[model samples]
Target: MGDLANAKNGLNIFLNPLYYGKINDNLKKQIVKVETTKDSAYFERIENEITDELNKRLSGVLEDYAEIKGHVSSFQSLHGTISLNKASSLDMVHGKWATHDDYIADWLSGLKDSIESGRPSMMQKIFKIQRIREYVLLFLERDFYRHYKVRTKDKPQENLWSIWFGSETLFWGLLISPRLIEDNWENKPGRIRKVEFGYWTIGHVLKTGLVDPENNTIYKFRDLNDFLIFYESILKRVSNSIYEKQIFAFYVDYIRKSQNPLLEPLLIPEFRYEGIKQKHKYRLDFTILNCHTGERIGFELSPQSTHMAISGIKSKTQTELNKDLALKWGREMQKRNEYFQQYGITIMTFTDDNLIDMKNCFKAMEYYLSKRKADRQSVDELIQDIISIK
Candidate 1:
């Protein structure tokens, strides 16, 4: 019974393929030991005990997998089916008829081999179960799904993506939040109240709507699509340079078409310092959060027009020109350094040359911006089992 308990530890290594290999090897070793033993009846009794426990555990796993399979099947018909080629390294035909037959053949073969060799043959079935289960969970737990879509009693029939953008008014209600006073200083008459205008997460914005106390406007958004339009409109209304417009536009369009739901689509524009008074209130052009890594990044488009422009009618000496040039350079570097020191944000500045090739400039940051899948962790018990056998 103690050996049986030790053997049954393999049951906990569900959905992990490498651990399944370890389990297969362990069972093989147990069979070898039983065959060589003088009093084989005792070892035979232990094998039977282990087999019964394994069967009971596998039965529970199968039942749970079946329930999840139904939800996943329904999800695929609405969105898109999981590619069978992704299931295994085996070359599967693109069509359903061919792939299904191939999969069944492989499953049966694996089972037969396991039975004949006194090893567990359920890895193939478990792998398939885990793949579809992971796919469904990814769809459900993704940032885009949580932020933009709502769980419904009845899911709408049409392609939800198409329907999302079909009408301007589609998801308006979800974004509506009550107007909040961003800044309320001492009630000194003649002092103008300032409302929040920059640097907000989509979740935060949805929870507490943007407020413009001066204009008496409260801004809300329904989905990521609506937020993009709002962001673009903000840039259009401001004095953003052509370089700023082009870079921002490309990033927005890229996220719109990409399937990676982990991307934070909107870059927070005109980011400002909060609850602090400074001699110079420096604000970032655009800021974004890396959802996968939880790193904050700042984008600055420094064209010659804005960054180097010096307006002075008085012509000064060589010393004056040097002083002014040094000051300008210092200011730019200070902004970058302060952001890094205070907020742990890395500022990636794009000059006129870099902005000219926006795609290439973005390529340098593609690693940080892209999706990062979670790494698989090894099971300690499974590792011990392998080490014991060796």
Candidate 2:
């Protein structure tokens, strides 16, 4: 009976569009040997691990979510779902998080209080932990339903991305932390938090929640939307961005001209069109404000914070030039940022007016400012600095 079942399953796997021509026969032969040894020992190893992870993470019971890994022989998607595990078994249903409304309500209250009080207690950390864990578990279950397999009640299609996936799960959760600080009732604090501002596609982990002192915060396992926003911020131009690379290039020239005319500026005009890395020539449309670097200072620009972008038009008549320039400046910042990273600085985005606004952009600038001051680094160091403000 087991042999017959394997024969039938193997036949279907070979015929499946996702696996058929995409993978060669050699890999397929190896996969069969591994997932279906006569003793089934190899297969059980992954199954037990995945099941245990699901059991530990999931709050409620559902076979669909519980036994997802066992049901699928293997999965794959190239719709550009880049992950460390993409080339292997394509089980990504373990991503995303779920949330409950009442929990969120309490979380919001606590989070607001913590922010205002200027102290994040253990209780607050727990709130951050619970909310973040719950949200991640929920997202994984939701993905199981949407992409993995149909519910027993079986609708032909999914209803709403928001229905299954809470759009404001973390957005509001960050609003409601365990802290008792007072803050504005209406703001979505997720956007202002430190991790949300990263320019790299470190992955979905950073995308889901406000990382606190508890449960580690990094993009390696962040949600899709969070990754998207970070990616969008880095790659896409918000407004008034122009040859962001060239602008930065010219800025460097301007600095040299004023301070060290003997020190010639970097002449990477090829990057203005060819891209800084030369592979993905995606341009940004923003201004790259070289963090008022002084030659005496070793690393002046906190490439993370000092980089500014003009999102809204300066005068906003909705003219082409205004929109185009907004985009152009965004590019300059991203491009110059390539050069800036070598010095261990990050690029922060600010609109032209906001850069001058002093009130709004001051703190954003200080994130990298402090990083430049510290001996330790990486995006993690800037997290608290950026989160403490908004």
On TM-score, the candidate that comes out on top is 1
- Which ten contiguous residues of candidate 1 have the minimum total lDDT? 160-169
Flag regions of model 1 displaced more than 4 Å: 1-209, 213-217, 260-265, 275-280, 309-318, 364-367, 371-390
Per-model TM-score, in order, reads 0.46, 0.16
Each model's number of backbone clashes? Answer: 0, 65
Candidate 2 C-alpha lDDT tens digits along 1-390: 332233234321112222311234654454356434423453354334434554554343222222322442222221112122122222122211111222222233334445567763322222122222233323332233232222111111111001110111121112111222253222233322222121111211233333221232312324443433432353333223343332433333343344322222111111122211224443223222121121111111223233433445455566765667667667766655653543332334444555344434434433322231122222222223222333
Badly placed stretches (over 4 Å) of model 2 are 1-47, 52-364, 367-390
Cand. 1 TM to true fold = 0.46
Assess candidate 2 and give its lDDT: 0.29
| Candidate 1, residue 49: lDDT | 46
Rate residue 150 of model 1 by lDDT: 18
